[model samples]
Target: MTTPLNCIIVDDEAGAHLVLDHYLKSFSSLTLSASFYNAIEAMEYIHSHPVDLIFLDINMPGVSGMDMLEAMPDPPLVVLTTAYSEYALQSYRYQVVDYLVKPIDLPRFTAAIHKVFRRYRPLTPAQQEGNTAAPPPSSLMLKVDGEVIRVQLDSIMHIQSWGNYVKVYTEQQVYLSPVTTTEIEQKLDKLGFKRIHKSYIISLQHIQKITHGEVHLNSGVILPVGNTYRRDLMEYFR
Candidate 1:
């Protein structure tokens, strides 16, 4: 007999917990290890338990779900559950297994869970010894306003900040988001996106020319490379 996947729910809403609980009861292959209303409590439980999957929420009172995920020593497969769809792109940067919008239907939830299971099947002793492979790169989902947009990493040119919002300039179009520059800076830094200035993070692939302390993008936009970021920018150029 196969072992049931040990799962936990970390959501701030009582209704969300109830909804997930009802759906989980229907799945014979799933076992609820615990449920938490906050990141602190959830962190404590996972440290003591062997959890296989996590149904996490994006926005919480004190510590957000994304924050909690970053703090995990060995993060389990995370499926984000949130009402705010705008955070979809940000969550993808964290390598979350999947993103589920709030008011989740049973069918969709089941399908997502199955996808996770299939994607992360446990390796056998021999396969593990042979060095199990990693999963493929995932396309990021960006929610701008009410629309869901999938942006392939290759199409991205650069990201620029305007006050509280960041505009992602892609080959196809530009996406505006109400997120801080620091937040976008942190997410994109590891994904080959370099901060050339306080206001600009350019995709290293789309940079066409660097001259006079400015970066010329493939799209013909010239962005200033800030003095603070100049040292790293010069190194990347070399």
Candidate 2:
């Protein structure tokens, strides 16, 4: 069997530790080495032991997570955990692998672990021998609910403007991202997506039929095609 990755959790909340303990069992490749309630103890332990990954909480009583990161000259791979999305952009300064919002679900937790493995996992000889032919899937990074998450482009079925936020519809979940529809339209227009109305954008690959100023998606979602956009949208069919 391949060696397991030694990971540690540094969070003051007892609930957080419990949640992690439950999730870690599902990943046999990861082993929890230690759990510290504060950054100081966690830092001292890291100085003396070999740690592969850290699930660090940003807010603490005295020493914050950022302070601990500043003290380490060469820290191991880190995944920042926080309850606020405002710190999302700031966390990127430390080059963390992923920023997970509090009350993290199993799918999100699993996604973060997979990202860690992608960054540190060793490649087999077969992989090293030019076996790479397929390109990586295109994805979009969006800030949602105080966390920056990656959503695969192809998985997106449609987007609907909701006040200051936009609801991103996918096969599994709908993400309410704090991004303007205009901003998202600019980013997705050239990538197999088109703005069908003032409030909606549909994925070209998901379109099943278009009739009478309405675009029908394969997922059974029907969105009205705005008068201003209908002529431009019909260009694709012609």
Candidate 3:
């Protein structure tokens, strides 16, 4: 039997809880362990309970979601849900699995859950029992020069947005695709890529070093880490 992941909701608003509870019912792999209206109570419950995931809200009356994360020496997989988009980059400081804006739809929520699943279960139960080996690396289908092309996730070093188009830097070559950075960010977030700047998204594995506000990729490419995103970028390495 597949082991179900235990999840908890920590949102102050009643409507927020209702929405998440309704959405969660669709996913059988996860079980709702508890719900808390305040960060203090939630923190207390977490101390005594075994929680695998947290659906946290950023704005609360007394204690915020980011505050709770800061207090915990070690935290469970976090998915931040808020009405504001400005908090999106800052929430990554806790290494959250995903940052979801308010009024989240089923499709986006489903994607976030799948990302959590991949992180929680790097190996299947059967693989843990020595039944099979790991799967192959994943790839992304991208439209480049009016043609759809297959790009290996591991081969990508960085991606830079050029107005409506994006330049994907890989080990072999650079592919210019007519896709927005926001669109590609959704696809790459599940993997180990991060949007460290409005115009730049980089593979975490390809980072050689960070110095003075610049990120040096393993391919000898240097990119500026935007001031707004610098905190989250530094938090990633920590």
TM-score of each: 0.55, 0.51, 0.51
What is the lDDT, from 0 to 100, of the residue 162 in candidate 2?
98
* RMSD in angstroms between candidate 1 and the native structure over all alpha carbons: 10.5
lDDT of 1 at 143: 41
Clashing pairs in 1: none
Per-residue lDDT tens digits for candidate 1, residues 1-238, read 2888899999999999999999999988889989999876686577558888999998897778977876664589899999989999989877788899988999889888878877677868898878756443333444466333457877888888889888988898889976677876765556778988988889888889899999998889999999999988898767
Residue 213 lDDT (model 3): 94
Q: Considering every candidate listed, which one attains the maximal TM-score?
A: 1
Off by over 4 Å in 1: 1-13, 16-121, 125-138
Model 3 lDDT tens row, 167-211? 999999999987799988987775889998999999999999999
Tens digit of per-residue lDDT, candidate 2, span 1-238: 2888899999999999999889999999999999999887687578568799999999987778887787675688999988888888988888899999999999999999999998885558788677566443387766665444668899999999999999999988999987799988877857899998999999999999999989999999999999999999999879
TM-score, cand. 1 vs. native: 0.55
How many clashes in each candidate? 0, 1, 0
Report model 2's TM-score to 2 decimal places.
0.51
lDDT of 2 at 220: 96
Error of 2 at 171 (Å): 63
Cα lDDT for residue 26, candidate 2: 99
